[model samples]
Target: MSERMTTATGTRDFLLPDLGEGLSEAEIVEWRVAVGDVVTVDQTVVEVETAKAVVDVPCPYAGRVVALHGAAGEVRPVGQPLITIASLEGGGDDPHATYREEERAGSGNVLIGYGTGHGGSGRRRRRPRLALAAEPTAATADPTPAATATPTTGGATGADGGARTAPLVISPIVRRLARERGLDLAALHGTGPGGVIRRADVEAASAAPAAKLAAVPDSPAAHVGLAPAADGDVVIPLTGIRKAIADKLSRSRREIPEVTIWVDVDATGLLATRAAINAATPDAPVSILALLARICLSGLRRYPQLNAHVDTEGQRIVQSAGVHLGIAAQTDRGLVVPVLRDAQQLTTRELAATLAETTAAARAGTLPPARLTGGTFTLNNYGVFGVDGSTPIINHPEAALLGVGRIVDKPWVVDGQLAVRKVTQLSLTFDHRVCDGGVAGGFLRHVADCVEQPALLVANV
Candidate 1:
């Protein structure tokens, strides 16, 4: 045979970038392109939700997507191959191959001020070689490198005398965990990022016998959320929305210095305004969330200082010109905050329509990435859940978040007279680094004033 094509060949694997967030891993929440699909450089190939935020990962090489290494909803580790791009034409060698390599090297250069610089090595660090090869049996034993291969139902050779068993496939994260726990992959059932055996699955399988026995009535394990005679271990995987929530909250807690202020307000006028708006627009029913969103937008306009975000790069606060209000919606998957762009420009009816559309999309898991970004402020309505008050966390990249509490009849002094007025609690949490207590208090008062006297907002309109 003539010389086989080597680097001259068109196919190249695209590894998952660090996304510049300094995170070692990310969950591939969505795949925008598939195998055999034509993709251009810089085109969004996958949507990955990092611990910090949801980011659209662009393709490094422009070519036909030959294969996707992992399935969607799988968590791929950093620097691992995610996609394979093959050149459209095959020949002795492509002239632009070197340029493609350079681009691949630069693919980790994400502009979002998130991802760290790509390390020099193209391949991930290999695992240490196993020492002793332990034969697979009913007995649990540490496996050696040579003993890594387990015999399936088929023998070493098939009926036709070909190699019988397929190689075991596992994800990088699973492999790392397996190495850490000294887990024998052959013995564990995979229930993780791909069919890769996770740590929890291994632990569960190991505890299964005891769990089954404990299922009997009056077992101590059963009384304490475990199996009856045995303790049933409950395993919850950190993936998708739940994973995102954990990551975001963790980052906010670690990075930002947060302070919260609470104020009780008369919500009678706000409720009336919402009812009037809904009656006026029968096609779109206005919700208390929309009303709170409008009040936040108005408050942001009055106190523009609160409408700013801390720029980590510049080490300064950048105030936004307009308001993009994010509404925290509880979905089956988890919590999603969808933004209503230019909330300052939208009328009550328009705001209601937009909120309805976004919430529906969030619930249906069909929200576009664009609609989920660029939020200057966020509103979490604990009121719907009958919560009177809650100190909400600030959505990072935004200065503040407003929590709207349930409205209830409570006695208050109105003009020095005891009266039962419809009251609601407003909790405002801000980044102490960028916002002072006075500014936060003023912003909260402004929102409360708008809510207590809906006429004030109408006057501006």
Candidate 2:
């Protein structure tokens, strides 16, 4: 970040626009242009990581780069000037113009919410933009080990102790890291330009010898030992997607009064149906998940109460018109739920295709923010991890989550005779605020009935 500079051509500063909901900051992963390079409108200027995924931010104005504000690897806050571009010699160019104005008239692309293309943009209503802070913003540089700065009630005091001023810290992730590690932010000196504290600065301080040895050894032998610390004693700092997941789960647990009800269903018919479908159409086969997804839709239609969210703000249960089915997907980035819009309308084969494509995108870290949101209900098949049953926490703001356990052969009574059957456990965790145990149990029983007899879904299909 830097002061808005103006010259003969009038330099227009481009601030980092808000990427998604609740994303206040992003890390500058890489810059596409250097100082003096010519840039065009809609051309990607930089790539940034904002807890969710890495996104390429496009320039809305074509100009010559006068100066770059933040460097690579530095986290910058939304509405902070990322680059200073000398306005081109044209009548439309205005040094005082903001990114929002240009984006509305030129690109017309809405970054979030309902829009045109599946993975792209469409025309959107103009939203109020955050006004620029009246000051010369500090530039963020690479991080280095330094003395931690002391936390003050107000901003940092000037070197002469004249006036209280704000520190050059921008990212909340940095604050979270410091807070979790109990590191003194005021004690650590910043390596960024204008004393901006980068994430690396907090990380280095967290790993500092003094900080690591803050805990005293329990025994003299432990103190004298040269062996590595125990696994349980190691500190694992939460960051990026992992941190987002932790925050969401914590909020769900704290806010939602949820109750889980599970039933072990004989999935023999469901398994048989999947096998027949796959064998009949080997070229475009259906999966067990697709079959189960269809059955879940049927149950949701019967008990519409389950396909809803507890809107605490509105003090009402918002029942959705269409089901936005969220499939819990596990990837290297962590567990993420990719939602399928109007999932109740999709055929089993279509669901299989969507699931495959969405899963691939999640694994490759290319899933857009639009694809990761608006989940009315979540289906967590944790059975892939080899678990029998789990009390799943409902996805925050969403009322219910269904957990499916591994489908394995088990002893069961079939028509009064004991026999080996394909069995799986189905757990439904719903928000008590939205529905009672009776409603939840009925929904679970419907799903179990479908699993036990695949014909139960024929009417709906």
Candidate 3:
């Protein structure tokens, strides 16, 4: 005798939510569940790497996991059904009804309620895949022992029982040489501690190929031969933050007519003011950038038009009631401009602390979505890199971006006498659509005046 079992009639599909960072897609780094694993709402089921950092994707449905559409290293488009969950027997009306019932009871998890319902029209648009072409192998490959690198404990492993090791843990300078010469990671024996790879090993391996190739003397006609056609172009697929940056920059450049104004001032008083402020408050020290940030905020307060953004769709100018100064931070990944809200209200010390916190978070790839958005103006410090002055590109949705150049000691005539003075350059790029040449010039002058005479900021405030 055989017993018949009724199959579940409905299945719930869990789609990816907009990770709250304006990211369109993410690459699946790892999966924590299998086909038969049971998952609860808000339980982390997978790890995804977005443009910013690695984020854990939580399960939106509570049931038996049916399937996973993509594997690790595959980039999944946003709003695509990633996993399917089969409703448990006696599990209420819908399989993904965890938060709905909770909401009815007036209590629910914060993020669980933000999940999208199952079985809706896919909101993600599929991007065209780029073809991966195999190039011919170069001759004179270095003869080195090929060893099966094993991953250390706590490191991620592959499915073949073979341990997965990090791609040669070497310094940046060494990595550059290894990449330029096409050296294999497994071939080089590391001289560093605990068999860890070193830069010298990579350099030695890289130099071997060049030395072998350099022996062959080139003929006079060979030098005349059509200069090795621009070492083949590389096509990089634009997605996520890079794609967004390109689109935004293009839109801003095309739509917004920009005018730039520059000014040079003696920032000696500004440095002294910062030192005094920092000396008074040991707990909260003011940075040079923070002092400039405060001056910029004060100048923006005096000239509110500088904090305005052009509304293309609305065909009008949108002015911000509050000053949200965006500090441009350069990270290994890319440039991220995190906003400091209510910049005008914060004192020099508070501004410095917030800037330090936000910039650190930005570099660590931990800046929240709210902190990265809604900036009214921007301050870009090219001076740190020894750059004298540069016309910085205006951060989109913001009317103006102020560029701060390096402060240097230069001879200047004060009261008809040549004296060494600490001078710095300031450049302001404003949207001509919202701000005219005079307004932009006035704004730059105002900022320069505040920096030149730090006491003026207090008077203006």
Candidate 4:
């Protein structure tokens, strides 16, 4: 349905602007203005959360808000009218009309598709009504009620076994939540207005059986022929960053023919170098991850093939000119890979500072969307989890991901003699479509070589 509501007055509808980088919708976290409040151009009126990050949406036109569309916590699609504003008393001309005029003149002050001489609200066409259907006569007619009676399409499985109806829901995030949990939208009753299913409902439905089972006595399991859970289980619904990670990983597994290759590296030299650097520059301490990142950058420079992505749609392998290195950081919002743009150019100290800043921002959920994307390769330091190694799935759309494991002391043959040294496992998972084993092996070897001798990076630099 058209989100715009109009009257005889000079009114302008401020539709939600496209937040760019494939963001289709956002949840209204809060509204800065209410109805009847006067707002200026470029004034942020709402804070919204996309699948990726939280963003503030600014209204483009200056006027008195005649109406506000969505409330806090409501997810609204892009191009939907966020607020309707009317011209001031005796202003005469509609701001929308002025915007359209400027749009025709090729003004660039507008959001991507709004008032920028592009498209307008493109609503889905309604299916034609059956001709034999009885038309409402004057006494029986009720247009408003009839329009309100229209059914909405929503989630995955329906209540009717084979018959599917559109799930009555508005938020994609909610739909994603239900779909992930395998909950049937039609089977559940909605508590929202107009019988719309919501996130809370899906979460409750998913948690219901677990909660009931938890409440059941252990003695009854034998009578009921059910095995009792050894440990109490908690069903945490995937949302926000957790959900995003799940979706990306699932897609990566499905689409990318990934192969993991690992090598044990004697990181005795790398650790000593890091310690020496920190000792000399206590104020600007270098992290182990930074040194490893520097090593990865050097490796990427030698084998640029692994430092690129495959565009399956275009059937092309796009090699990035410079490494936009993605550092995998586990934050409160789950795992996020924040990219350091043009990392190939940054010195070890600069890389350490940037890595620290980005990691801090990611953990704080304050990193910008730009910093969270466009990675040619990912460096995952799962060593923080104290694991020896893992066959990690690649961060989708990227050609490869390098995993670093915990550095531990292990006995090894050094100079043909038994010796203990700091050792770490390095795993590289690469997309098979972009390169073969030869290229992947070489890249992994380069990284391992650097770890074994930190001076390798200095020579490459």
- Alpha carbon lDDT of each predicted model: 0.66, 0.72, 0.68, 0.72
TM-scores of the candidates are 0.59, 0.69, 0.71, 0.68
How much is the lDDT of residue 131 in candidate 1? 12
Q: lDDT per residue, candidate 1, 189-289, as tens digits?
A: 55643344544675565456643321223422222211234366655566645776887888888888999899999988888888887788777798887
**Candidate 3 structure quality by residue, lDDT tens digits, 1-461:** 00112255456667767776567788775576778776655455676766655565655456677788797546898878777877666645644456434323322222212333333233321211111111112222211111212223335454466765555442332333344445545556677655656666766666675544322123332222123345664344464456667887887787778878898899998989888877887688889999889888878887899898887788999899999999998864468899999898887778888999999877655555667788999999999899999987788889999999999999988889999999999999998888678778888898999888888888977
Q: What TM-score quantifies how close candidate 2 is to the native fold? A: 0.69
For model 2, the superposed segments whose C-alpha errors exceed 4 Å read 1-9, 88-237
In order of TM-score, best first, we have 3, 2, 4, 1
lDDT of 1 at 305: 83
Clashes of each: 13, 12, 0, 4
Error of 3 at 142 (Å): 50
For model 3 the local lDDT of residue 236 reads 47
Candidate 4 residues 1-461, lDDT tens each?
22243667778887877766677777776576777776554445666776677665655555688788887656788898888987666445544335334333333332322333243333221211111112211222112223322453323343354545655654444544555555655567788777777677877888887533212123221212122354864445454456678889999999999999999999999989999999999999999999989988888888889988888889899999999999988764467899999998999999999999989777655666777888999999999999999999898899999999999999999999999999999999999988999999999998898889888878997
- State the lDDT of candidate 2 residue by residue for 74-113, as single tens digits: 6788879988787655445544344435544555433333
lDDT of 1: 0.66
Go through the candidates in order and give the C-alpha RMSD of each one to the true structure: 13.8, 13.7, 12.3, 15.0
